[model samples]
Target: MPVRNALEALTMRPTRFLLSSWPWRSLAYLTGGALIGITTIFAVLFLLAAGVVLSVLVIGVAGYLATVLSGVAVGRLERWRMRLVDRDELPNPHRHPGAPGLRAWLMCRLREQATWRELGYTMISALMLCWMDAAVVYAAAVVPTMLLFGPVYLYGETSLWIMIPVAACTPVALAVAAYPVTAWAGARAAMARALLAPRSDDSDAKLVELSRSRARLVDAFEVERRRIERDLHDGAQQRLVALSMQLGLARLELADGSPAATQVTAAQQLAKETLAELRELIRGVHPKVLTDRGLAAAVGDVAGHAPVPVDLDLRLTGRLPDAVEVTAYFVVVEALANVAKHSEATRAAVSAGVRGGRLHLDVRDDGRGGADPERGTGLTGLADRVAAVDGTVALSSPPGGPTLLHVEIPCAS
Candidate 1:
C-alpha cells in the first residue's frame, strides 16, 4: 500500500512503516497541536479576565466578542496543519461575507454553523484532545530516548549485564513506538475533519445557489419555447393558410381541363398539407392549450391522442405552478409516446393528483415490460427535465409484463 497518509502508512510492512517519514510527520503534527492547544487555553482565559475587569466600558464587549470569534482563526490554522498527517485537503466551511466590511464579515461568521462547531472543537482540543496527543508523543519519543541513555547514566549503580541488555533493546523499543504515535495522529486528524468540514446536511450556500440558477434556466427555456410557438402560429401558419385559399380560388377560375387548373389544384393541396404540418410543429413546440387551460385539460387532450387506449384519472382541483405543470405534462406526453411506439400492450393508464403541495403523476402500460432508461429511452431526458424543478422519477419495469413510471414534482403554488 502507498503511504498517502499516516493511516495508510500503518498498512505497510513493519520495517517499511518504521523507515518511512510518516512516523516523524505524525510526531511533528502532534507536537504542533500540543503547543497550539496550550497557547489557546491561556489566550481564552486572558480574554475572559479582560472582559470581566472592564465590564463597565464598551471595550469590554470587544473582548467577549473576540472570544466567540476565536474559532475562525483556529479553524484556518488547524486546516493548514492537518496536511501534515492527512494527505487530503480540508475545505473551509465558511462562506465569504456577501458584503465588504469588518462588521459584515463578523456577522457572517457568527451566523454560520461551522463557526460554532469550530469553537466547540477548539475547546475540546484545549481541554482534552491536545493533552491526549501530548501523552502519546511523550510515551513514544521520551521513553525511548531515556532507555537509549540509561546504560551510561546507571552504569555504576546497576550490573553491567543488565545495563547492556537494556541499552541493546532501545532500537526495538523506538521502532515499536512509531505505530502508536502514527495511529493517534491519524485518529485526531479524522476528528478535526468531521467537525470542521461541510457535509450534505450543512445547508451549503453554493448548493442553494446552484439549484436557484437551474430553476431560472428552466424558466428561460420555457419562455423561449413560447416565443417560437407564437412566431410560427401567428407568422408562418397564417401566411400558409392565405396561400392555400388563393390557390383554391385560382383553380376555380381556370378552365375545367386546362393545364393551369391542374397546376393550381396541386399547389392548393401542397399548401394545405404544409399548413397542417406547421400547426403540429407549433403544438409540439408549446401547446396553446397548456398555456390557456391548466394541466388537467392539457393531459386530457394528450390522453385522447395516444395511439394506445389511455385511461385518465386526474384529481387536480386547481392549477399548479407553471414549471410544475409543464414538467408533469411533458412527462406524461413522453411516457405515452413510448407506450405507443414500444409497448405491445393495447391499453395504458395515466393518473395525476395534487397532495401535500406536490403533484404526483403515474403512467403505466401492460406491455412486454423491460424498460431500461440506460438504453436511450426518452426516460433519461424526462428525468433531466423533472430534476430541473427539483422533482423525482421512479420507474418499475419487470421482464414479464407491466411497466410503471411515477413522477413527483413540487408545486408550491
Candidate 2:
C-alpha cells in the first residue's frame, strides 16, 4: 500500500518526481531524457570555448572574475533544476565579494580565468535547454503514440495473424527501454553542471608561497646561528682566553705582596665576568646542553627555571637529528613561556613523545586562557620554526579557560 501511495505521489507531480509508474509517469522521463542529451552537448562546447577564450585573454584578473561569475551562474541553474525535477537538495555555491571601488573589482575580475569559463558554460546551458525541451516533447509524443496505435495497425494489416501479435508488442517494448535512458540523461546533466563550476585558485598559490617563505626564513636563521657561533669562538672566545692567561700571571706575581694580592683579586673577578658572558652568548647561539644531553635534558633545564610549576613528561628515547631536536626544544620553551606570561593557570603540563615515526609535543595550562596566534609574535615565530621543518603547530585557547599548544614534527626528516 505504501509503495503504491509513494508511486502515486511521484506520478502526481511529474515535474518534481524522478520515479513513477509507466504511461502516466512517462512525461517526467521524457523531460529528463531530453535535458540530458542537450546539456551534455552544450557543456562540452562551452568548456571548449572557455579554454580557448581564457588562453587568448591572458589578463588574469578579468579572466578570474568572469570565470567565477560563470561558475556561480551554472551552479545556481543546476541546483534550481535539481530541486524542480529531481527533488534533490544540493549545496548552494558561495560567492566572495571583491574589493571596493570599480577599478579594484574590475582588476580582480580580469585576473580570474575561471570566471570567463563559467560564463561560457552558462551560454551553453541556455542552448542545451532549448534543445532538451524539443527532444522531450518529441520522445514523449512518439513513444506513447506508437505503443497505443501499433496494436491497432498490426490488427488492420495482418487480420490477427501471428506476425500481427509480434508487431503489436513492439511499442510496449520501446517504451520500457526508454526509462533507463531517461535516468542516465538526468544523472549526466547533474555531473556536467558540477564540473563546469568555479573554484578558488588563490588558496593553492598562497600555500606554496607560505611554504617557500618559511623555508627561506629557516635558512636565514641557520646562517645567523653560524655567524653567532663564529663570533663567540673567534672574537669573545679568544679575548677571554687571553684574559685568563693574564689573570694567572697576575695571581702568581701577587702571591705574597698586599698590592699584588689586590691586583690578583681584581683579575680573578674580571676573568669570572668574561666567562659568564661567554657562556651566555654560547647558550644563545645553541644550548650546549641540547647538543650534549639531548632534548629531554634541555627541556628539563627550561622547566626548572620556568616561573610556573611545570610538569614535564618527556619520553623521547633515541637521539633525533640536530634540527629536529632543536625545533622540539624551542616549541616547548616558547609554549611554556606563553603559559607563564599569559595563561593565568596555576599549573602547566609539558609532554614530548615519539610515536608513529613522528615527534609529538604538547604544552597545556589551566589558566584564564586567551591565546591568540595573530597577536603574539612568539607564537608566530614558533609557527615559522615548525613550518620551516615541514612540521605543524596548533593552538587552542578560548577566553576564560585552558590553553593547549600542540606541535608535531616528522622525526625521519
Candidate 3:
C-alpha cells in the first residue's frame, strides 16, 4: 500500500516527498526486486543444468516440472511485492479443472497461456529487470545516503566543507529519483494485471447471452401462437359453427321438394367441414392440452393421433418449467412424426420420465429405420428448437430395422 501512494507523494511539494517515507519505500521495493531477480537466475540455471545433465537418467522429468513451477513461483512473488506500492489483490485468470488432483492441477497450469507468459516474465526478470532495479536504487537512495553522510567520513579534513554543499542537495536529488522507482513499480503491477487477469468475457458471456435470447424468442413465439389460437377458437370457429347451424335450420324449414333444400344441406356440410379443419389448425398452432394438463397428458394426446399405433408411458411428479416442457413436447412430436412418415412401422412406443434433473424422452418404432436429417425429416430444425432451451436430440436409426430417438432437456422442479 505504501507504493500505491507513491505517485500521490510525487505530486506533492518536493520538500514533502523528501520529508516523508516514500523515498525509503521506493528503495525497499527496488531492493526486493533485486533479490527476487537473483533467486530467479539461480533457479533457472539449476533447472537448465539438471535438464541437460540428467536427461539420460530420466530425472529430467523432475527438472521439467521444476522449470514450469519456477515461473509460477516468481510470478507469485512479483504479485506479493505489489504490496509495497499497491493494495489490490491480483486475481489469477486460470480456470479450475473439473477434477482435483496433483496431475490435474499440473495439466491445468501447463495448458494455460498465462503459464508461458509467466515464464517469459521470469526470463526478463532474470536477465536485466533486477539490474535496472538495483541501478535505480543506487542512483536515487544509496548514492545520496553516502553523499549526505560524507561529512562523518571526512570530519578532520578540509573535504568536510565541500561535502556539506553536496549533502544539502542530496535530499532533492533523492526525492526526484523516487519518481522513476515508483513509476517502474506501477508499470510492473500493470504488466501483472494485463498478463494474469481475465482479458475479456466475450466468449463465454456472449454464448450464455445468446442462449438466453433464443429461449426468450421461443417463449414469445409460443405466446403469439396461443393468442392466435384463442382468436380462432372464439371468433372464427364459433362463427362458422353458428353459420352451419343456421344452414341446417334453413334446410329443415324448406319443403322436401323445394329447390333450395339440397343446396342448404350442402352449405351446412361445407361449413361443418371448414370449422373442423380450423379447429385442427388451432390445435397444431399451440395445443390447449399442453397448457391445461401439462406434458404427460399432452404427450398422450399427441400419441393417440399418430397414424401408427402408439404406446405411451410417461411418468412425472408435476409440471416442469414452461420453456423445457414446451421444447420437450415439440421434440417428441417431431420425432413421432418422423417415425410415422418414414419408419413405416406397425407400432411405436413413447417413454418419458425425469432423471438427473432433466426431462428424458425415448421414442422408438419397429419398422424400416434408415432416417436422417439430411433426408428432410426435419430433424435439424427440431434439434435447433430443442437447443433453444439447452436440450438435445439424438437419432439412431439403422437400416431395415427399429428406429430410436432420444431427447434430453434440462428442467428444474
Q: Point to the candidate with the largest lDDT.
A: 1
lDDT of 3 at 375: 81
**TM-score for predicted model 1 compared with the true structure:** 0.79
- Of candidate 2, the 10-residue stretch with the lowest lDDT total is 1-10
For candidate 3, give the lDDT of residue 144: 69
Instruction: Encode model 2's per-residue lDDT on 1-413: one tens digit a residue.
Output: 23222223433444344344433333454465356446655564565566667767664444445444554555556556544334336543342334688777555644655556545555555566546545656765676566656676666566556555666766555555445434434544455446544355645544666777776776678667767877787788778888888877777776566887887778778887888888766765777688688999998988887899999899978798777888888888778878877777798989999899889999999998788877873999999888788999988888987888889998884
lDDT tens readout by residue for model 1, 378-409: 99999999999999999999996699999999
In terms of lDDT, model 1 sits at 0.89
lDDT of 2 at 35: 65
Tens digits of lDDT, candidate 3, 1-413: 24345556567676666777766766787788888898888988888889888889998888978887787888777777766666677766455654899899898788767677788888887788788887877777677687788778877775756878977977676666777877676665566566655545423544666776787888899889889988998899899989998998888899996779988888899998999899878777777888899998888888888888999889887999988877778777888888777888999999989999998889999999888789889889998888877888888889997988889999974
The best-first sequence of candidates by TM-score reads 1, 3, 2
Candidate order, lDDT descending: 1, 3, 2
Q: In model 3, which runs have C-alpha deviations exceeding 4 angstroms? A: 1-201
Once superposed on the true structure, which residue ranges of model 2 sit more than 4 Å away at CA?
A: 1-206, 209-213, 230-235, 255-264, 304-309, 339-348, 365-377, 396-403
Each model's backbone clash number: 0, 26, 3
Q: In candidate 1, which residue pairs get closer than 3 Å at backbone N, Cα or C atoms, i.e. clash? A: none
Q: lDDT score of model 3?
A: 0.79
User: Which run of 10 residues does model 3 get worst, by summed lDDT?
Assistant: 197-206
